[model samples]
Target: MSYEMKPLEFISVKFSIGLLLGISCGWLFPIPQELAILLSTICLVITSLFFLFENYRKGIYFGIAAFLSFISLGIVAITLAQPKLSAHHYSRDYNQDNGFWILELREVLKPTNFNRRYIFQVHALNDSARSGLILGSIQKEDKISDLKVDNHLLYYGKVHPISPPLNPYQFAYDSYMESKGVYDQIYLNPENSIQLKTTGKSLKGWAAQIQLHIKKELSSTPLGVKEQGVLRAILLGQRNDLDPEVYRSYKDAGAVHILAVSGLHIGILLLIIRFFLKPLMSSYFGRSTSMIVTLLILWVYALFTGVSPSVVRAVAMFSFITYALYLKRPTSAINILALSFLAILLIQPKFLFQVGFQLSYAAVFTIGWIYPLLIRFWRPRNRFIKRLWKLFAVSLSAQLGVLPLCLYYFHQFPGAFLVSSMLIIPFLGILLGLGILLVLLASLKSLPDSLALVYNQMIRTMNELIGYIASQENFIIRQIPMDRPGLVLLSVIIILLVLSLQKKKFVYLCFLGIAIAGFQVWNLYLLHQNRQKNEVMILHQVASTAILYQNGDVLYVMTNDSMRIKTLVENFELNRRIQSTRSIPVPNSFYLGQDQWILLDSSGILPPVRKNIKGLILTQSPRIHLGRILEQSCPDRIIADGSNYADDIRRWRRSCQIYGIPFYSTAEMGALSLGQL
Candidate 1:
């Protein structure tokens, strides 16, 4: 029994165990039980086949089987230990009042102006009503003074189930939470809530305390609000305080990921460790000690940064690499990454759907596999040039890998990311290093005022440079619609093409190129089909409501409110390419202007008169009377705004009956389109 074979066998067994455990855990959720059973069966079959096919070597097979069995037991134990059924049941039913809930507070999501909002994991909560636990956007307004993590208080509030936002491209808050295994929303009422004190401490609470300490220390530094905020966000994951403009600057510069502690930050930390331990690396024991210390510090930093999935993934992968180095064993970066992924999935399988998780892995995988291959082909002469080229290659590789996922999630791609990353990546490393140094110095009581001043100056200089780069007009940022699945297919094809190039497989490359071209053609066909289809879109409105009707190239908006008109025109691009523009009047207006026809006020109008009308559409309540007028006119069809008809189906039905008209509500019929009569 060879040692190499032992590890290989162990890995195979572990893989089978993981698969079975994952399937079973998934079944505990709302996933089809039959599917889970089938998957489990398949896993068992595969494991059996591996054992049967591989020659039975006593020591090797036994060792491998034992290792696998242990791994499997651990996975199953963890899965069983998880509050899977409770969370799963809670996610489905929203009406519950168990009077208690438990969740890991993840991030202070976004501040709703002066009313701050925080997003955290509701790991588990009690539902007294037994309508399952709800997970969504929990809006709880608190006095700015009393907000802190792990500070449990009893409060009552209405729970609203979080769903996808009304707009297609809008943020899917529900989906985002679902990725974190949250399926309900709680909006805590500020007035009637009484704080029920609980004395408890958590690792997150300690991390929050450390963050607060660091923030206080940073405040004393002579740094501008924006600089300090950016530094804090990069170092401590405290993005709540970041200035909108400063944040935009980083986004525009394609350096937004720098603010989020990730692989880049970990890389910087690793570099610092290497520099500090250069002398100690001479001895085996010294090197081992250095590696352990570095791994511990890195994980501590991850904890301080709230242990976000991205940060955890970065730490886990890097730790594996460090361990491999310490053991004087060659480790494949991709294999380490796969192991990290398996570990994360074992903890929280829901992250498989998170955009952050997807993007993080995609970027790392690209850098690990594609970057080296790219550098091989396009090798530069000068050392500095080569470094710059590698940076460009890294950025390009990441962008290519993540392009489809980004488009699927955000529906927009920053065209300037490549150019921005070139300038931002190296400088970002410098900033993170300096920021960490400042934090360490601030922790020491003997730190001088000059140290603070220097830190402030450096941050200010970095901001200025960032600002200048952002201000450049050449940094093109365009928002392209990413609804076409064919575009995603095209992206996949591009990745395949790039991969094929590494093997010098011209035939595969050619096939990939053809597939890409075919995808583009298919995309164009879909877009043309969409353009041809007559569409009546009822837009989601906050300030005011608007409805759009499109026939061929013609666009007809039935709202006179300028704000609503402007919002629709700006946000949805109602008139992107076509020039045909027309407006229909509200019920009160009498005169027909241009292509716009006004519906006469039916307050005193004769009902028996039948006039040929194209279409009858109701806006708000005042237009309901127009149904009688519409009845008299005998319009082809009737359409009513659903927003105005909230829970008034009986009234709507009565009106439809009286008018003898076929009725359609905008809410029931998502987007209605009427073609030429």
Candidate 2:
């Protein structure tokens, strides 16, 4: 904690921080295109001048300041250059116009049950020059699997903007798509008026084709379907074929990173190659040859895995270390980590928003920084004990880095993470080595049943162990709901606590306790606010409806179906920080302050509505004449939840439009808040 940073470490940290800050500023306040371009050019010149003129300067302090400014300016240049991302824009009337769009499929996503989706670039809109990324989905079929990246497809459809989440605190599907540069969707049924033309091969297309071939070979193996799927995920970074429960098991057990193909996998592969080629690598030249071959093989593995972010990150960091060792230079883990991050973000600034990218960097950086301190705390006499203790310390350090972010995003903690890690990690290197052997043998059609059986059994045993650990539901803590403020404080406190152990500062420990206490107090204060809330809310869910009316600490929920009550109420209950929830049947009515609500559903039961009746609630696609009802009785608004059909909601909306009545649909604008808050 009291140690000074190495010169390289300090510069790397400053560069990474400045780059992130620059990106944040650019995103928060976008400037005019011309201004951005000019500013970027100026910054680039300044940075170039700083580096070129650095030899003329003296004193370490001056050198440090000059280099920091150089990095800052370079980052500002990159941030400003992001205007180039939006250089090509969709026309204003593109969404409204419907026609035959001849587009080339640029990026093919995994196929779903009903459709195969791709991000297509529009080459021609009815032979008119136009360009933009369109999310095109063609109907799924046995033949549709032949579609490859860079294939031109003609489709007739209206491009509609992606819709927002129809529920409170639901996954922001639209925002997620936007982050990926997809704004409009063209839902097409290729069984009818769809044309497919194969274009020239692309790297991505080639990668996909190779992956498909590999998958077929693996599928033909004697291994179980789910087992092969998991192995493929481990080797090739493909998880769509994995069973949902199996994936969840790995995640809950805190061993999900095994499937992600990171530093551990790459490290294992490098070591395996080095060990096997040792006989030929006895000479000095052979050692150098081995290192060169290993590095090339690592890159090839990255290439084969479709150059995924997690894989690329690991490869980049390892590549840096390898290059340093190959050329005989001093290396630093923190510096390598910071460089990899900056390199990735410079290419695509938006990757900074990715959860995987954030967590990967955080875990690596924490392990590099804190694991050393943890090991220094206790020195084991035995080598085995040292290795075991090191593994535990590394896991703890990584978890410490990721725990706050995990709680903020997932709202749960896997208590068995350390246990699952301890059991699986020591053998992972061997498991990976065997997995590679199996793949190589299987691909070459020379796999022996005995070898295959052993590898399959290892995988099966690992899966079962992880699944058993995941099933310890009592150890898994759920619904922590740590907000941004609490998460930040908790992360800082954790760092300080570790530093306290290193520096032997009790004051740091006291500050850590105070931060925890502050988070608890803030959580309780928010709970009190929620307990005092009074309102009626209709939550939006797909084909389900739940209306909540709460007054003070009491919550009464009414839904058309009882089956989804548990899933629907979880977020609300967590928001309120209340464990008890009363699921009542659709009642005659409910009240919030002076307002009244009448429950009407598919039964078409409509109570007489007057001025005091605040809103008319519609659920389960009620069959009634809304215009006639509005004429007979006047209410403030007509509210419909997600249980109603989309067609019915549109029809009712039109009717309300004709009658000049204010209409609200949960399926359209998200959950409706009525009465008092």
Candidate 3:
């Protein structure tokens, strides 16, 4: 017997899919802002007409019109979201050279090795009022005291465009910043930067102040520093003070989400709140009041926790569910979830590209879809067994949903996630509740040392348990290779298989098999391509030089540096799907196919060659006169690796220009690739 399929209960799901497709199309194939606006207007008119005409409104025609409208709207949203398209954008109007600008510090970013960074809202340029965003970095040694959100600053500096990735398959910092509407960056000179006092404070500023106050209050307690850090992360969504080791442990244990104040935390808090409000549901007035109170608390928590995108998303989603449940209407949870997804994307379409947003929604949907299916398979009568089974089911479902994403982005999966989830999740509600209560008391200056100590011990115990799980490294899968095509195909297979299991349908199974076949074919194609690949690449490494020679399934690396770049090489191997790699010391001469290349180091010795070389590679700030070398060798191009000094490279570049020979610098133009050589 086949499971009966339910009729489409919510039209919003279809609309959401249409909107999602439209947003994806808009991103993949961007249209000009003006054209997008025009298209949107046309689509809107068509949709309006379809709805107004009684004949068209009843069938597929109306749906098509609505979908087209959403697609056009998505195009407009993305085009408009681009700050570079705006006439008043700083990059479009201002000088990149030294200029006076008024900037308000909007957000504090994680500090890098050399600098403390912040997202600054550009308020004025050359005393002209304008609006934009730019990244500002101050040297760690010149740190300004008491910097807070909404603080204004007068800066005199040169704005530079964010640099592109310096290596293939490297994370694109420029693209990431551009997505967030930050197009340029300014490095502050201490002498030219000055803080400006501002009277008006935004909600974010107030939130920061509240967090600071809480931190200060908590410092007086007997809580351990690590415990305090975890508390701040849990309650205030701040992780700047978290110990790196502890964070790594949590990540390895696949429980880092617990510290991030995402959907799981929000959901747990909601459950706690609902349990407390169960009695109020008996009366309509009480229920309504409880609903209002729950919403207020949730929103307050969202705001209090820095109003992060993830927090806001979770709150918005749960808020919808709360209202739907309280109204006593036959509402589908999937519909509510889709409505929330649609709403978020409509407001911030770029969020569709965010890893966090995708992972969160994926986990939630899988939990909702798969948990019930698992429960039906095993109905345990014992209360403890049933609770354990439910937790396992939810954990397994979430992990399955996010597995592809994790492999794609992070290239690893924690096999111990189920164990961590089973162990920690059951106590998460109590922990969150206690943390909240402790924070409130701390804010009121009434938190006792005894209570603080107890909470601190609990945190320590949790951390230890997580660390133990993470230490079982044998179960942790790392360096799993996956690409965008594989991600999509695998996702299809997972979805079809789940559907097949849920509905007991042969059609779904057939589709699942097709998806699996496609995935396998893709891998085989990649493997074949890797086997036929042959290339020479000069990598960009700071204060060092490295060159790669790839032949078929093997990679050879020649480097002057002794530093352990095993991880970097592993990443490369994963991307290439190579069988093996060999490392060797850098030699003065190398051959690519029949072409000869000569490396000139600090010694500046030019070896006598009978024939003209293919290229002259510069390394270690070679002191040889480039004009002489050009006159002597007359190679096709000059290449400088990262080991060369900037002044020397500039001098060589000028010489190359003078001689009309092509020059490549790994530092500026990224890794030089001699394709298929």
Candidate 4:
């Protein structure tokens, strides 16, 4: 009936303190001078009051409160030290200009498929700008031809502060960059002459050099391009150079995560270290020394790999567990994890909203809590059976943990992930071991080519096995878009029920029911909500135009280019249920001849076949048709794609005024949506 104070209790206390601190910090963001002083004074007074409480429990509570208050004070101090407007906001209304100019050149992050553009984070130099990071996209053709990390010559680019993309179910590139203090977008001008500054070196530069070294070593070996690429990806998180088709095959087969360096990668590294240190761990000095060495090496690896937030989180948790093991002290996985969370949040409170941070923690927590219970039910008879069961449990737990997130952020689930993971995860350990050995051996000039040849063959066999698994017929890739609220609520309820359940069996059942029922309910709700929200989305198209419309069960996409049509169809998964009405010719009657028009009748209202109607919806405005469309349609509303013609704001406004109808453009209003009339 009463609460007891214990080490475990600190977990809850620390979390509560962190949550309060975060809220206070969020409120004090872009802190006003008056507000900062008031809050700091209040915090000091509260800390003083808590310090005065003489009772041990009360004193401990006060001490914790005071400690957090002091932390908050430090945050305020840091905020005041930096330029007030330096922090980037990811809001849609944020301006793209009014910032200092800087140059950035960084490698792109995502896969470069035929339809997809690659996004990159540019490393800026020479400019002493407040926040010197920029996000930009490179066409696949350009990237394939001209971009080689270190050797590429610099080009002049315009740096502008732009808001993040507005797709709710897609990746929040804005939020991701905001966490790392970037809030601007860059547009490169190929023709602009610029001198390349090669004076200074950076961590990114170092990482790029490492990648080049790895590539050179792999080239000299007998491994083919595909195998070499996969090895680089799995070992060093360098998937940029991988073949597009191979990447897609892995993604479609649900084995793409194998290429990403994640917790499983860290676990493999830990196991290799533990395997070699087992004998030494029996002795006192050997145990302490080995633990220290392993921790240091793991952290060094983390840094070498660019210290992605996910990797840092995994390394910290692993280091804590290893230290506990070395000290011969029992450690609660949950408490240790909570402590790690508390530590990370304390350092970078903004990471609380990062997708990778959330997913990594969710996956690890799910494995820690649910995997044991799952294995308990299917008790393995032998060591081999135990290992098999463990693999299954880990795969199931991680997938379940990350499913909702995958749906929310990526809008797709790799259906073959479970079976594919089971097939590949066991060999991942071997891949890491061999990769480490290969790196070590390649460093030694005297190492035998025969040994390198054998290792190269083994790596090639593993890559081929992965390729085969990915090519399976039953492998499915389905898109399931659930917005942010849905994902957050589902995660909260699952975590809550799992933690509160009294028995392990009941906990598993609760999680299963919640997962199934929650997904169905959430999906149905999303479908219903989407039905009511009729809107137009103007996508970024290279050569042609595409527009999407939704009304009830009918969805219409108007596009001229067949490639654009395919892109829209696959991206929206329109073939699943929506009915396609008819393909119409480019409406030459409005303004320009031979101009393409793709129109859909989702609302069941047919367009005027003969007459130049009172209203003309031109998705984009080119020089040819502007005057004619204005003369003919006398359109009630003209909605145009904003990216290309944003510069024509004055003329568009004047035309709209003369016609006495409203004009709206996407650049000013963000993405446009219209209600079903």
Highest TM-score against the true fold, candidate? 3
**Count of clashes, each model:** 17, 0, 0, 1
Writing each residue's lDDT as its tens digit, candidate 2 over 340-362 gives: 77777777777777787778878
User: What is the C-alpha lDDT profile of model 3 across 1-677, one tens digit per residue?
Assistant: 11222214457777777778878887778877888899999999999999998989997889889988877877887778777777778777775578889999899888888888899999899888878899988888885774789999999878898999888778899989877888889888669899998879999898888888998998989998999998888777789989899999998999988888888999889988999998998886988988998999999999889888888888999999888877877666677888898888888888888888999999987877777788899999999999899899999999989988998998889999999999999998889999999999999999998999999999999999999999999878877889999999989888888888888888988898899999999999999998898998888887888888888889998887646455556767899987888988888887777888898888989766646999998989977778988997889999998888889889999999999999999999998887687
By TM-score, the candidates rank as 3, 2, 1, 4
TM-score of 3: 0.95
For 67-164, candidate 4 gives per-residue lDDT tens digits of 66655654554344332234432222224433323344555455446422223333333343222345555555443344434333343545555566
Worst 10 contiguous positions by lDDT, candidate 3: 1-10
Writing each residue's lDDT as its tens digit, candidate 1 over 547-631 gives 5666665666766475644644543542233346677743332222212222322233333322565455555444345555665
* Model 4 lowest lDDT segment of ten: 595-604
Candidate 4 off by > 4 Å: 1-131, 136-158, 163-172, 188-193, 196-204, 282-284, 443-460, 471-477, 496-525, 532-540, 570-613, 619-633, 639-675
Q: In angstroms, how far off is 651's CA in candidate 4?
A: 7.7
Q: How far off is residue 336 in model 4, in Å?
A: 2.1
Task: Highest lDDT: give the candidate number.
Answer: 3
